[model samples]
Target chain A: MADSVDTGRPAPRTSTHSLVVEAIENRILSGELGVGDMLPPERQLAEQLGVSRAAAREAIRVLESHGVLESHVGSGARAGTFITSMPTAALSRFLKLHVSLNNFDLDEVVQTRLILEVESAAMAARRQDPEILQRMGEELAAMDDTDLDREDFGDADTRFHVALARGGGNRLFADMTQAIRESLRAPLLDGYRAHEDWSGLRETLQHQHRELLAAVAAGDAERASQLAAEHIHTSYQVLPADSGGSRRQGNRTAAGGV
Target chain B: MADSVDTGRPAPRTSTHSLVVEAIENRILSGELGVGDMLPPERQLAEQLGVSRAAAREAIRVLESHGVLESHVGSGARAGTFITSMPTAALSRFLKLHVSLNNFDLDEVVQTRLILEVESAAMAARRQDPEILQRMGEELAAMDDTDLDREDFGDADTRFHVALARGGGNRLFADMTQAIRESLRAPLLDGYRAHEDWSGLRETLQHQHRELLAAVAAGDAERASQLAAEHIHTSYQVLPADSGGSRRQGNRTAAGGV
Candidate 1:
């Protein structure tokens, strides 16, 4: 019988550390190595894979960073490394970086933010709790402060949207909503800084925030969704058109270099 | 500095590796670790932190797995580790695994998918090029083949939706759409096999697909978005209402284990 056609490509002429790292990731993703499964001893695994112990050790470290594996300090068999399962924060950080890389343009990001926040606002309107609404109120109050700097106002604005998303009562939606919104913080601040009418802009934003919070508080799903979408689109429209915010940032930089 | 006050805790036994990982992540999130910056050398970093070389090496490996670090190997001073960015796929994988760990329930997944796909379909209707529309048509055709197995049909179904997202002309929206849809592949297939009326269900799905494509082809954004949302909701409604189709599989396994 033919040898399973070697599903992996031949390792490039790189360090052995790279090869070992890839092998371990393959095993984890393919489900051959699952959560809570103890890895074989380091020396034995190194021997089986025909690599050095240093390479195997490096592979362990890589997986540990991704939260794919955990190790305890001990001797004997119990000291072996085991697979771990972590929260989506690891993934969220990865996405945040990708967004910063300008793989997607500003228009695209704005459009996406429109979709997510509109949906989140609608859901929040329909199923919001008192605590979340109170949080939105606080953020609005902070934005209304006349002494607030552009940076502080921008931070408050971000918090307000994040609160609205959390009020939607869906963790996945809330997390993605927060991630995408937070990803825009830098650019939004840049826009705010470039504005000569910072006070006027802050006043306008605060007005919108109060209206949106009231709509959501009253469970006005249709109104809330429309307002959220309009707010996002309008903000993007108002930003300085000359500066290419997307391209000026880092480019490419995919997680795996793809 | 009063020796940092220790809070009267048990000697503050945190590992040096863990501390390094957090510090690095903090820098990245705060925009200090921009792409193309070189990380401190392993030996130098170890001494700077007052930690062993092994700890520093481990921290480096972890960041590498998250796609935050890349390395160059050379005989001279040119060799060093570099900070890098990751791709959306990495985030998607993290989201998928997070969902698997029950961080978000099945209903949340379904609802999030509905919100994303509907907006994506609407965008695709307005912006998709002829080539993208053609690829979507091909995916639909693949699903129409009666001889296709459940796996291939599910894959084709996913591709059809993914193609629509890609055509939406918004990279962030498309990435989010693709991630949610791709994550649903396994559970959706499992749900498909659980139904007794497989042939009838398949026919219904095919009809919906045809209707959706027709709507897209006609450039009816409103109709396409509405149809896509209904399509997603209808599928979930068909699945066993208990804990979704996967729950049944899980219960059976639990009973067998007992």
Candidate 2:
């Protein structure tokens, strides 16, 4: 069993800046600090943490990059670092690079997506939110344009999935769904551009989207879930076999091809 | 549909450091940079990107935090920033802060967990690796200790779940499952400590864990998924109502109580 209580005490092995990072994280996790709350100035933080100003600055930079904190420079109480919430962008960026780096295999990613999106589609169907439904339809319509480039079509495709995720009425699920879809955007577009049977593949995807949307609109949770799973499976199958093979081989070769 | 093709060019609205960050991210995503590839020196990078040294340094800090790069200091060929792959820790840290800050509600988190773990449990059941099964049994046995404290039991509980996740044989799913479980470690322990009838709650959890493990061991995917879902629901039901309510209220009050 992994240790449950971290105690928030920096171990001797941890770096100085990382210790500062953990100290701040402990505060945030323990609720001593919170969103919209400004952090102390670099000097004060350094003094309080008994670390150099450079270490504190590095820690702040790390937190800022994670979307947990935002720093504003100027001369005022509001100008220092303030806790912020922007997980979606940060999560997307993290997942994208990891996925690109082959830290998570393609099959694993696709399976995870299937698990999340199938449930999300079912939940969205149960909710039957008209606004989200409309957004999905609009994305479908945008994809129907025959003259649209592969990149544009991929954007519409991503938006359609994102809309379905949002329709589930769960921000966490929606954010994750969005992140995964966005992370795969480039590779999916590459798949589209590489396919010899572009028109046929596009028709297949469009038809699946229409059917999936209809299931959601009709509030058939089971049908929506099944369709979502099938749609994802079919979509991924169209990608070149080498696209998601490995970090060194697949991504490197695919990058050159693009 | 949002723009899909991020042409590596920096937009006028983007900050100098952010532009540098994106430029590097583009290379990583495009597979131009792979693991173990060293980045140019800060001065040279800044010169090449037409940005200040400070900008390059800040960008490196951001990328390093994202687990895309690692920096080493000293006067040697090996001492430089190199692309790295360590998404597990970085991803966990991001999710923990976001969950702590109430960006994702407890209900949403539990629901997401149910979706992931249920699928994960089913996958594990299908795989049925004896080694993983044995590890899970050991964790359950550890939890069987009547004298175990709330913290120790919590750690055992987390390990049991982690074992189940690993059994699924999907790195992405396992990593996410671990992150979510670890993120809620403190809150779960607090819940355990605060419960009026600790013994009764422990008995219920142990029973559920046994049943779930049996389902997995028998390779009954459907039953395993159902049991996993039920276990999660019953477990979270024991947590206080405000355990996951909001950042300012739920966590702050709970922190004080703990």
Best by TM-score: 2
- Tell me how many residue pairs clash in candidate 2: 0
Alpha-carbon local distance difference test for all models: 0.68, 0.80
* Residues forming the 10-long window of minimal summed lDDT in candidate 1 chain B: B249-258
The residue pairs that clash in candidate 2, if any, are none
lDDT of candidate 1 vs native?
Answer: 0.68
Runs of candidate 2 exceeding 4 Å displacement? A1-13, A47-50, A73-80, A245-258, B1-13, B38-56, B71-82, B245-258
Tell me the tens digit of each residue's lDDT in model 1 across B1-258.
112122311122266776777677666656566666787888998888788888887777667666566666554544687776544454555555555544555667777677678877776777657988899899998888999998899888888888887776666666666667666666677678898888998999889988988888888999999999878866765544443323122221211011
Q: Encode model 2's per-residue lDDT on B1-258: one tens digit a residue.
A: 011113321112256788899899988888788877899999999999999987788788778778788776666766787887777667778888898888876667777778889888998998899998999999999999999998899889988998998898877778888888878776787788889999999999999999999999999999999999889877876676666535534322211011
lDDT of 2 by residue, A19-78 (tens): 898899989888778887989899999999999987788788778778887766666555
Alpha carbon lDDT of residue B187, candidate 2? Answer: 71
Model 2 CAPRI rating: acceptable
Please tell me what DockQ candidate 2 reaches. Answer: 0.41
